[model samples]
Target: MPLSAARTALGSATAVALLLALVTAWASGTARRLKSGVLPIPAITFPPGPAAATSSATDFQEPYFPFLEGEVATASVSVGDTSHGFVVNAAQVTQDARLGILPTQLARGLDYGTEALVAMLEHAAAQLYGATKTRLWLGNVGQRGGGDIDFSVSHNSGRDADIAFCYTNWKGEPVDPPSLVPLNGQGQAPKHGLRLDAGRTWIVVKALLVYPRAQVQYLFIAGGLKTQLLAHARDQGESPALIQRAAATLRTPVGSASHNDHMHLRIHCGERDVLGGCTHTGAVHPWSKLYEGAKRLRTASVAATLSHGEAEQRRRALQRLVLLGGSEHRRPMAACLDDPASGVRTAAARAIAVLGGRDDIKPLSARFENEREVEVKIAIIQAIGTLGGAGAGRFLAEAVGQPDREADRLLRALDTVTILRGPALLSVLPDTAAALSRAIRTARLLDAAAGAEPHALDRLGALLADRLLDSDPIDPSRLVQLAAIEAASDSRRLELVPALVGLLQDRDPTVRAQVGRALRMITNFSYGVSWASASPGTRTKGLQRWRAAWRRSRGAPRDAWLITGFKAGGYQVPRLGQKQTWELVRAIAGADHFSVNAQAVLVRLLDHRPPSAQWSKNEACQYWLRWIRARRQRYDLDKPPVETSNACYRPAP
Candidate 1:
């Protein structure tokens, strides 16, 4: 035979030999001995043959398969935050063509998930497609080891999976989507020539809810698609029980993608997995089997581990207790505050901060006095601050006056005052104001290059604003008064405008300048006098102009200045000068009094909003800054703002 023919004969013989081996294994019931459900398939042994020299016997082993019984042998574990978590013993979903589900990004290897999650997906897809010819497309679940995946914030764990929405043509014929198709409010994907198949999608959702292997936690879908699916289910006379479950599970996830093109499903951690470091957040639905008994068991197990386990284990246990969240765990957590391991003590302090109440202030303060480790002491202070009360405020007030206090501790104490706010800190303001004033003076005199106290001045400014602004007669020190004025601008203390105007004639030129700058920042009026460089006569006239402006504006609405040029149509920078426009932009980007309102006006001008409403104030500001930087020239102050796309801005590398 020719060489090519011989090669073809060898390949044919190898295939035949593998087929015979599988048949023989099945006949002998060796495959039957394997456990059921979605699991790693046991390696199959093949008889040595001519082809074995070229191909390893392992090549003939079957891929993981969903078997007869839906019980997982080794439960998969999902641990830590969903965005930064990892999974252990994750099961790879079967990729067989016959399963009626296709991996959207196979090369990325993001198809692994917990056995329960994999089984749920397989079962749900089978139930949907078994009655019809339509197919389901699966997106990312997690990587093989179940950590971070690309373009996702919450698929780090095996519990979350993304499955594409089922679609149909205008004629109602099933269409296998090549990828996820984004749909508009009317459930139509006009660009793709497809409409959402609400009925088929409901079937898959129902199966996921009814699946015995895992409890559905969330089914994230766009609001419009969710509405259509629920309406179709009700019209079809689906049981109210199932419909209600679907309604509760379907949501538009906050702080992440809206999931408009596909459904993002998350499953609750199993009871066994919970004991092994898996975590579940949000509400536990009534249908879930994880009840008080499971929680009690988990709590007890964590307590035991904290008592006997190593430092890392005890730290993890403390974290798990915080997640469990009950008053019962408080005693154990408080006890861990004295653990030999500083890491455990730090973890305990943080846990107490989240789960502790006002009563926890005593223990935390006591720990702070004796804790030698700087990190542990900082954590205790933070806990006491977070659990702000009269007692906490008093403790923090006294701590701030300590002559040898570290910069970080002082900063933290100041932050706690801000957190305490209103009555808690107000009742103790006299002592706090005096201590903070001294600290501010000391901080100023320190060498600038210490670098260990970065942002100390800024923090002190904010603290002075929060407490000293309400003082009947504000601090006498020039530095303290100056700090308060600067802070008022950033904090948008609308009520402080009169006091700021009073400070316009202060002896110190720098304090007078800051007050002028703050007034302009608050009310968006410069009054034609540059306070910093102005002569005595110009300063006097400018001060008069500010007083007149304040008198005329005092009776108006408190927020009138913030919306001075804002109309139903959009924001118009009042003067259209480059300086005015930049001032407005700075307010929008800075953590000032009207930053949020500024951001809203900017959003209106651009016809854009952040993708998720859950973005922090800082995140939103950073996003606007990036957007403005990219299109600075196009933003003509004289013209009406142009509309921009609603797409989210990706963070710059």
Candidate 2:
């Protein structure tokens, strides 16, 4: 498409996306506070003493709102009853667990209590439902890198949160954001919806009522919340009871994750979840549970089969098992791995992955190596990964060579190397690199000796860096992974320096480019300690390599050549603008060791059209939709506006 036509298309998309974002960005208006995009979404900066204590939850007096570009400003949170107020740094919200766009509430400070519940829910797994299911984080809040959200704040409260589930892979990565609406309760996470059953909603509410000091305990959420929480308050202290009573009065509107990103919880300090404090609460009246028929009901014992007619009867039972982590059934999740039914066995594998101990390693390994069925093997790998450790890594290594192995499986296997960063996980590296540091040193050995504790990482690295010594058309992902090895460990790729330098001239641009980026990182890490003091030859070589890569780059230079360096895009970068030029732009802008892309990345977006709104009313659909839409617009590939030879134009910076 012509450049002018591309600009027109991008403008249309931008208009649609922005309008939808403004319209659907409502739930976030009611959800709660957030600290996203606050102070650059980078690694946690450690304070000199005791991590600077990171301002305790109680220290939050006012809500935090980090400046988009400037320093995060703070306020004092002073709830009427609490004489002492805490200071809330707007910048600190990034670390807080509640990642959705929040809405406003009548009473303030109570939202923090709601955030506590979000944190726990963020940790919930299918095990909580007695299913060996793995969940994925629903929204960008739980994403590794930083992101922007269209958080709409009404009044002073922020209650929107867009959360999703995370499925624990064979790497045993953490899962967050359970879904209220799944895609017909299937595995296609993107197809999910947002309709939350009332009972499940009640579980969320009751959980919050149990904690006090959480000013948000009073927010009116579900109609049934007050009654449920009041019953829980029976055996608990008065403070909890007061909080539950306070939660009974809040009632408001909510939208799906589309525009707004979180489960908006508005806190009214003294407001009850119900219209009036439910006086009819005593140990949560079981009388409300009316069985449809005696024949349908099982005996009042664990021996009796559960009745499927009661709707959530099965779900609640599963929740019980999940809470117990297979303890309720014995041996954590071990029993399910061997279940006769494939689905049952699959679920068991997932649950056990999250709850079981190292004892599961051998069994999960056996299933992974020996299981004939691809699905079962995949499940087993995920279970081992979820369980996490050296065992998982070993299992992944063993599975890597299976015929026609799925790429997903390979990635899972590779992911195990970095997960948890525990000794059990690092054991997969060659030369016994127990953790990141050891992985670095061991990977440098350049020996294929299969001893002392060498693992697949060593094998893969040795094959590419030392063994495959020549540049060839290797699998792109493998090459990309090799390029990434430098980041995985701290060791420099000097041995492969010559190899990487040669790749710049290789026919395969993808291979050549990735090699160049990796090489840049190696040079940067080496210079950090003594760049200014390096020998003339070493400095010259580094400069010469950098200049060569920059000159050869088809598009923008990479950040790996700069301060942070390119980590590479994890998922398919959406096509932006009419011609969808991101791949082109990334190739050019990401050519250097600096954030040279930053200077031009946004400019590219400013030049393009935005995406159609993905905001849906259903919870799950809304969340994913908004994320896709917003991210698309923000990263639009249209050339950004800049001064040129003549008039302004959007294209290569």
lDDT of each prediction vs. the true structure?
A: 0.55, 0.30
Cα lDDT for residue 504, model 1?
Answer: 68
Q: In model 1, which residue pairs have backbone atoms overlapping below 3 Å? A: 492-593
Give TM per candidate: 0.46, 0.26
Clashes of each: 1, 106
Candidate 1, after superposition: displacement of residue 372 in Å? 3.3
The deviation in Å at residue 376 for candidate 1 is 2.9
RMSD of each: 21.6, 25.5
Whole-model lDDT, model 1 = 0.55
- Where in model 2 is the C-alpha error above 4 Å? 1-149, 152-216, 219-320, 323-332, 401-653
